[model samples]
Target: MDVDFLLNKGKTIGLEGLEVYMVETELLNLTISSDKVREVSSSKTFSIGVRGYIDKRVAGVTINDENLRVDAAFEKLSSLIKTSVEDPNWAGFPPPRKGFINVICRDNRIIHTDYAETMKTIKDLMEIMKDEAIREGAERAIVAEGMTRLGVQKITTANSEGVHVQDECTVFSTFMVLKTVTGKGESDKSFWIMNRRFDLAELESLGRDTARLSLMFGGGRKIENGEYDLILMPQAAVGIIASTLIPAFSALNILEGRSPLRGKLESKVLAEEVGVSDNPELPLEIGSRRFDDEGMPTSSKVLIKDGVLKQVLHNYYTSSRMKLENVGNGFRRNPSSPTTPYPTNFFVHPGEVKLEDLQREVKKALIVYETIGQWMSNPFNGNVKATATHALLVENGEVKGPAKGVLVTGNIYEWLGNKLNGLGRETFTSEGIVAPGVWVEKVKVATE
Candidate 1:
């Protein structure tokens, strides 16, 4: 579609400002069940979103059909904007900005991946899983379900304010559930990995780790109720931090009175060793992007500096309302949705202590690998109640055995603040969250 023509037409219709967003996507998906390829599918889709401003109010419309008529869509969008109720806080679109950086977000290999290559990857993953299961002493491990998806997306944004930007990105993701049945009992574990680049060796490592965890899950025992030091692995820590802590840093949440950091800016909120940043410039990271959905330039910003509440994530709307700087966190789930603030490549800075050293520092603790019901926890008040799916009991700086059916209960603020002990040197990224192992003291762990 000709974006220039659309914008001209909107202006001629007496609209104050206009913006258009287009996304073209091609995806390939493969699913495996019972250790066999179950289905393979491919899809191609195109969507166009149009936003118009009249007076101070703005509204949007999206068209996904192949037979989209740009002229008719623009007419409908104008009518919707005119009929929509005016927002008292409505502000004009962001003015054109300069000095935009280019980030490498696409992989040509993944963009050109075909059905044959996808099938080969599936077969290789199955073989690797089998080999790793045998090597891990879970030869009977069965892959109950698995999925592999590869996608390429082309995004373009144009506004009447002389802003035009375009970019492309590729994504590869895979997940699997492996179950092992022993003479004593049955145990299962799941693993997931995603990245812009394809690495068969990484997939093999994931399989080996999953198989090892499943094998250890057998003959598990519950721990007694007590106050124990806790070592949260990267996966377990991300599950809680991303769900509970990260959302509180949004300016919108604070404006809505749902965030604990509303009036706590520049205050010490966590341990002095704790630092957090939203870095979109990291190479090969999934969330790295040059511009946000609103055509605003993105940059790395320190959200928390040495435990002090430094900054909150904001988009054009929230920043305008609060009279703050826009950090390029604008995001929209789809063309028809309103833009909101969201983090990109969010992570916690690693400390100097290594994971092994941090573990040795603890006398008695639980090493949590994975958890359940983390998202259901409260984020505003910082209450975390989660069940450890895979955990190891440690005593006298020695791992005893697998501990199951253990509940980890604590307040996120306290655990990350006064109770925080150490952070691991090694960092791991999962679903765009990069973090290291975190150690905390005086956590409540019990069977119930």
Candidate 2:
């Protein structure tokens, strides 16, 4: 679609501050189950999202129908904007930025990847899982489920405020679940790897590690309910930490009185050892982007430094309303949705202690590997209650055995603030959050 034509058409129709965002995506997907290929599919999608100021009120519309005419879509959008309700806090779009940091967000190999290559990758991964399962003494190792997705997306934004930017990115993601039946019992574990670049070696390691964890899942025992030291794996830690902190960092949530950090800027809210930031320039990360949906330049923003609340994320609307700098966190699920501040490549800085060293310091603890129902927990109050699907009991700085059907419950704010014990030196990235294993001093754990 011609973005300039859309903008000019809106202007000619008496629209003010018109903007256009177009996204074109090509995607390929494969799924496998029980060591057999189940499905293979590919698709292409084009969507145009338009926003304009009508009578000083902000309104927007999205056009996704491939057969629909662009001119007719523009006319419909103009009519809707004319009757849209007025927003008292409506501000014009951002002015053109001078420079944007060049981010390595695309991988040529991924973009050019074909269906044959994708199938080969999945088969290789399945073979790796089988070998790992045999090494772990499982009677049989089956790929219970596996999925591979590859996509390339092109984003273009043009606005009457003299903002015009276009960028393209490639994404590769894979997930595998290995089920092993040993003489002791049967267990299953899953692993996920995603990035802008494809690395089969990393996926191999993920499979091996997941299989090893599953092999250690039998011979469980119930534990008494009491306060004990807890070590959260990177994936587990991200699930709990991100769910609790992401909401609090949103300027929109703060404005709505739904955030604990609403008025706590510059205050120490976390432990002195903790620091957090939103880094969109991280090399080859899936979340890296040069600009936001609103054509605002993206950059690394430190939201917390040495336990103090440093900054809250903002889009143009929140930044203008609150008289603050826009850190380029503006995001929209699609063109039809309103833009809001959201994290891009959010991370918690790793500490000096290694994972082995941190575990050695724990006298009595539970090393939680996976949890269920973490998203249902409340973030505003920092409350979390999750069931550990795979956990290990640590006694006297030694891993005793697996502890299943256990409940790990705690308050995120308290654990990260005062009860924080240590952090692992090695970091892991999953689901857009990069973090290391975290240890907390006191948490309640019991068998279900």
Candidate 3:
């Protein structure tokens, strides 16, 4: 048996009744390759985590071994049971738990040694992209894909008063990223990619198109900073929105004085039409899970409801601290779960206009794509001072070609929020999230 277990220890010091929760084990292993060479390889680990509540304070610790020093875990928790300064609503353990439903899993599937199929699929995908690149005038291109298999078994238990649970789940998936390079000499440029489901043929096409974008960058020049119609790719939109604004959905962040969305609960955040959610139900995604690590069922949870802030993601502690509902986002990668606020399977619902339509509406505007040195060049302010790998100068409803040595610098929120003119019909669901392309106004563009 590939068994990993956790030993738990605890002592209650208060009248509120002490409780201890333990997760027995979780397993994982995955292999990914490219160009017939394996790039990512690893094996599963059996691990354990223990959480203890004493005098309204919570502490947790984790270990991975056959002879788990459960008592030692408690010894360490001695220092961890410090009082939290912030006040939270108290809504304790879930009532009447029925482990995850429709949890997609299969036995013997975890041992997939399908190197042949992986190579063949990658070859086909690269070939398709190579041909597409030639058509778009690129001399060379490279493509890569990463596949993963996830299997985890979790068990949660409390010292009788309530809560004892366990569940198992597994998943398999793959993702591709393609890059195409073009031009000659000092004019050489590259276009990155377009998001799509894991398909090599489509991967090739995206690479080709991206390369085409770089090649087209010859005719672009600096345009003054001002308000103009705008069209944004899904990647660009997500880059800005996620980094600048989305972190506030955490009840932890709000309580900790770390989030900008603090004190704005039940208020409007995004545009009225904007609604955000996490759907573990997405067909295939890295974030898909049978149940939250705490053995809580993960169902659809609406974060921003028609622009109004609704519920926030929570774990057992946060739910216990703040008498609010849990959104089932309690996820801990290691068994000793240290509560961290994060997003899993995030998404921005798409609008109805297609990319082509948004482009036409630009009508003498700049199409910004591919930002580099986003963290460095922006000086940590997330004011993306980016050079568009495939930026185009559009005029009178036509693509007038590309720009080079150009820089776009500005606050993502101010530029995107007030200027958000429209959104695209299509979307990319990669890394377990989705953000359709967007259209905005008022940007600062310059030539280097």
Who wins the lDDT comparison? 2
Give the lDDT of residue 194 in candidate 1.
73
lDDT of 2 at 30: 91
lDDT per residue, candidate 2, 1-448, as tens digits?
7888788888788887888888998889898888887999998988888888876676777887564476777677777777888988888888888659889989887877888998887898788888888897988888989888888989998899999999999888888888888887888888777778777777778877888887888666777778789888887887887777787888998998888888999999999999999999897787799999888899898999999999989998899899887758888888756788898899999987766676677888998888888888787877888888888888888888888798888888888889988888878887568988888888988788
lDDT of 3 by residue, 1-448 (tens): 1112222224332323223344443333333334333543445456556555554465666656664675565567656766433223443344545646564333344334354554565556556655665686766655444343334334554432344455444444444444445654122233233121234454455555544554555445556554455566776665555555455566777777766567767987566667788777664455566566555667777877777777677776576667666646776656555555456678788877787766666566777665554443332233555665557777888876665556666665455355666667887655566788877676766666
Clashes of each: 0, 0, 11
Worst 10 residues of 1 by lDDT: 130-139
TM-score of each: 0.92, 0.95, 0.74
Stretches of model 1 off by over 4 angstroms after superposition: 66-83, 357-361
Better of 1 and 2 by lDDT: 2
Q: What is the Å distance of residue 235 in model 1 from its true position? A: 1.1
Q: Write the per-residue lDDT of candidate 1 for residues 61-130, one digit (tens) a residue.
A: 8878665876677788888888889987878778767767777778777867789987887787777776
lDDT order of candidates, top first: 2, 1, 3
Go through the candidates in order and give the C-alpha RMSD of each one to the true structure: 2.3, 1.9, 5.4
Clashing pairs in 1: none
Order of candidates by TM-score, top first?
2, 1, 3
Q: Distance (Å) between predicted and true CA of 252, model 3?
A: 1.8
Give all candidates' CA lDDT scores. Answer: 0.83, 0.84, 0.56
